[model samples]
Target chain A: MEITPAHYTVLSAALFSIGVIGVLVRRNVIIIFMAIELMLNAVNINLVAHARYLENLAGQVFVVFVIAVAAAEAAVGLGILLAFFRNKETVNIDEMNIMRW
Target chain B: MAEAIAFYTLAVLILGLGVAVITTPKTVHSVVFLVLNFLCVAVLYVVLRAEFLAVIQVLVYAGGIVVLYLFVVMLVNLKRAPEAHEDPRRLARLGLALSGAVLLELAGIVVYSYGRVTPASAPAAAGPLTGAGNTEELGWLLYTDYLIPFEVASVLLLVAMVGAIVLARRES
Candidate 1:
């Protein structure tokens, strides 16, 4: 059977759903960040697949930007995580309620 | 044929590792699983003909980002189980239900929208960089059509690097 764009979309969607589940269900802040990365990867897959289907290089260009942004996000986010962990001595989201009213 | 086989295998591995990245008890193990998941996605990018992206995905994601995660995990030395104190009001099940609802909504949207539109039968006429290779075409577009955004991304990275240092440094 030939692989179609829809097949890639379905796979992307499933992977994204797993990421969503991870973010929502996991309490560990670090794991949540990994879930966010998973979601980003899923979107990248969709972008590249459609870029191939449409023969458009712009989608690939956008993927490059996405990677750059994801890198910056991971860096800043992990730095924040380190600072928070130092103060709270925990990585659980439940304990990260400093700003919660 | 081979493409289908490879795609299915990678898809399974990607999804499975994504699950493991969340469900694993140990943070370090989860980081390892995340790296594996990224490598699999890089291979899929190759399958999709985004060779430059595949390289970026491997180098920045599996190589750089996951190592950052590992370092943070090691530095945060958990003296006690972080998840030991469960908040009384924490609604774990509700979170699961909400995620399931989102999944269903996404699936419905995909089925509804995709059924209506027909895919272009042929790859659209070779794009502007018709004669160029993948990386060359990407570079050309980055320098020409996307120069401003590319410059902006570099600036964003620089700012983020500074901010990260400021945030992670110990206060005197």
Candidate 2:
């Protein structure tokens, strides 16, 4: 019963699937944002796990970049969400059918 | 043995919190659960011995990004959680089925690929940062191969900051 890198992958994959489910099942824009963050963090875990297992530092470096990107993305994304909420007075993503079929 | 226990525990926590974040009826609660999930992920990073990544994950994700979400949630002032009610349309159930199928397909892919690729038997103790390999190694590679992307990320953050200011400005 060793915790291998594969275990981390399985865990990350499960978390990633939950994020996907969040994206699909939930129509709350803020929830969707959180789900997207979950997905990103899941990917980061996978990267760091492989880096540690293989004794590669590059992957952890990539994780740092990923964190930076997530921060910037969240800032802009939430601001846009705020603007949309202000105008629409609701954050229901389903009602945002501007380009939907 | 202890590692396995911690792994399983963190795995369950991450997955459970992830699901809760998505399925919660309240957006604020969902954001809070998401922060918990991120914090659990940071702990997993610690187990991987990526201490730098774990610290960054906690700071950038649980602290910084989650706060941004909380602010947006408050600013939005959503009394009723958005998308609380699923559409009454006929396709909702079908969409669920499709999503489940896709997840199954992905899981199958993971199993098949993992089966084909045999894992190395031992976890070597070659610490990534030593005299030969250090965060300096990371700095070298960053300045060499990924310099452009590194600079671009900075620019992107600046742009995002400006864009946020513009988009969320008080009405003139």
Candidate 3:
């Protein structure tokens, strides 16, 4: 069978759901960050697939920007993780309730 | 036939690695799984003919971002399991149910949209992007039409760099 955009879309959705489950269930802050990255990658896959199907370069361009932003996010997020780890010596998100009401 | 096979194989690998990244007990192992997942995505990009983005995925994601993750993983020092403590009022089951709802909503949107306009029926948006190569065409677009966003992304990266430094620095 010829591969259509739906195949890619379904695959992207499955990957994204896994990322969501990761973010929700995982307690490690670092792993949660990785899950967030997984979600970003899923979006990128969808964009690229649609771009290819539509013969548009815009989707690919958006993917580039997404990667840049993801990098920036990872850097800042990991930096915050380090700062928090230094203070509390743990990477657990449950303990991240300093400001919780 | 070949294309379908490739897509299926890559999709399985990508989803499997994604699951591994999230479910692994060790943070370091999770990072390793994440790198593999990224590599698989990069390969999928190649299959989709976005060679430039594939290279960027491998370089920026597998190369730069994964290294950053590894460094952070090392620095955080996971001497003790991070999941030892459970908040008494935490709604873990609720969170899972909510996420499942999100998945169902996304799937619904996909089915609804596909039903209205099939991908096979839609007119091709425009002529194929013309240029010397994938990288060249992408680069031209990046410099010309997308120059503003490109420049803004650079500035964002700069700010993030400075902020990361400040955030991670020791208070002596």
Candidate 4:
């Protein structure tokens, strides 16, 4: 029995779309952040799958980079959320109107 | 046959937990659900024969990063619950419709994409015994092939860490 790489690719797409749905529909800031993580992990899945199927290590290396970027994004995003909460007293995404024209 | 079962099972668990994470009302509950989701993905990585990555997924995501999220959640007293003012009916309807449509579209795409592709699970080769399975290989690659980006990630984390501390500090 052989599981081709296509399975992982499709699964990744599904996972990514799920994350997109969460980002679009969820109003909670924390959940949305988690959704963003989901999307990044989804991308990682695609990268790993490609690496395996192609017998190349490039995609795996790319996933490593993705993880690093994700870490940076999480730290900064959460920090900004913390600071924003200090001022506004809430983490609701809709309430982030400070930058709104 | 075994691989088929595993794939189906992992796929169900991954998607199920993902939905749960997003749909959970409380941020804390969502975070917990997200952890479970990450674990399921780790298992999926094992199935894909990326053993190193599977471990990395658990260590970094489940262990290191999620704890950070949990700390932030606990530190910020969010008992008020999210979106206290939004109309529940509208939001619920929107979520339901959106997720449903997305799920349907995904399923459709997958089914349609399989015009000629049947699910095939090749027996795992003895292993990446050459060295691919070893953490040392990963580290070597990271330092040599990826050294520049690797250093940049560290500096990025450093900046983020300090920035988070400053931003999250108590005003008093």
lDDT for every model? Answer: 0.90, 0.79, 0.90, 0.79
Which candidate tops DockQ?
3
Candidate 1 lands at a TM-score of 0.96
Worst 10 residues of 4 chain B by lDDT: B121-130
Clash pairs (backbone) in predicted model 2: none
**Tens digit per residue, CA lDDT, model 3, B1-172:** 8778999999999998998898889888999999999999999999888999999999999999999999988887777789998888888888889888888988888888887775565435344653466899899889999999999999999999999999999999
Q: Looking at the true structure's interface, with contacts defined as alpha carbon pairs within 8 Å between chains A and B, what fraction does model 4 recover?
A: 0.45
B128: Cα error in model 1, Å: 6.7
Model 3 pairs whose backbones collide:
none
lDDT of 4 by residue, A40-63 (tens): 998898887767655566677777
Task: Report the C-alpha lDDT of model 2 over B58-142, residue by residue, as the tens digit.
Answer: 8888888898888887777766757665556536556567767766876787687767766665566655455454456767778
Interface RMSD, one decimal, each candidate:
1.4, 2.0, 1.4, 3.0
Cα lDDT tens digits, model 1, A1-101, are 87878788888898898899989888889999999999999999999998898788899999999999999999999999999988989999988888996
Candidate 4 clashes between residue pairs 3 or more apart in a chain or in different chains: A1-B121, A1-B122, A2-B120, A2-B121, A2-B122, A3-B120, A3-B121, A3-B122
lDDT of 2 at B126: 57
Which wins on lDDT, candidate 3 or candidate 4?
Answer: 3
Q: TM-scores of the models, in the given order?
A: 0.96, 0.90, 0.96, 0.84
